[model samples]
Target: MAATAVPTPPLLQISSTQPEPGSLVVEVDGEVDAASAPELSVALEPVWAAVSTRVVLDLSRVTFLGTAGLAELLRAADRADAAGVALRLVGGTRCVDRAIEVAGLAGRLPLSPDLGHAMHR
Candidate 1:
């Protein structure tokens, strides 16, 4: 008998909108863990490469985030900072919020309770 394989859930989904000049609003959904960190990095590469001065990461739809995800966020932030860009995280759920706080990145990275607030920041 042949064995059936189970499908793995995607690590994350990233979509972007250019609401205005010099900024990119990216919406991220689904889980971000060790298995999906590389994919997430690849997804954000183009946005970073575009030379935007500001990037907003919308995490309202992100349900799960692990250490790998947090590390990826920090790495992205560093790249943005080096490129003279600002990186902000918006609409983080409880788990995301706790993880950021626990990782001691709450202050280093701009964080807002919602997309509206993040965009304004």
Candidate 2:
């Protein structure tokens, strides 16, 4: 008997929107590994260029986050700082939070518990 090959699903999905005049929100779902980290970086390109006062990255739906993903996040922070844009990370899953925490970046990154808090802060 021959074994059947299983198909792999896409690693990530990213979407962006302007929730208000001065805010841009990018919602990310699915896994963010080396294969998908570049996509996240691409999705954030506009964040570095936007004139918005605030940029929010919604990680509430992410299932997994890997080292490359963390690197992209650090890149986002650096770009946001250079652009003078306020970047907020919201609703990260335990997996995502743990990865960041283990990396000892919980304090360096702007993290909020929810969208409302992120928006207000």
Q: Write down the lDDT of every candidate, Cα atoms only.
A: 0.84, 0.87
Off by over 4 Å in 1: 1-9
Q: What C-alpha lDDT, on a 0 to 100 scale, does residue 116 get in candidate 1?
A: 80
lDDT of 2 by residue, 49-114 (tens): 775598999998999989998899899999988998898999557988888999899987757889
RMSD of each: 2.1, 2.3
TM-score of each: 0.87, 0.89
TM-score of 2: 0.89
Report RMSD for candidate 2.
Answer: 2.3
Off by over 4 Å in 2: 1-9
- What's the lDDT of the predicted structure labeled candidate 1? 0.84
Worst 10-residue lDDT window for candidate 1 reads 45-54
Number of clashing pairs per prediction, in order: 0, 0
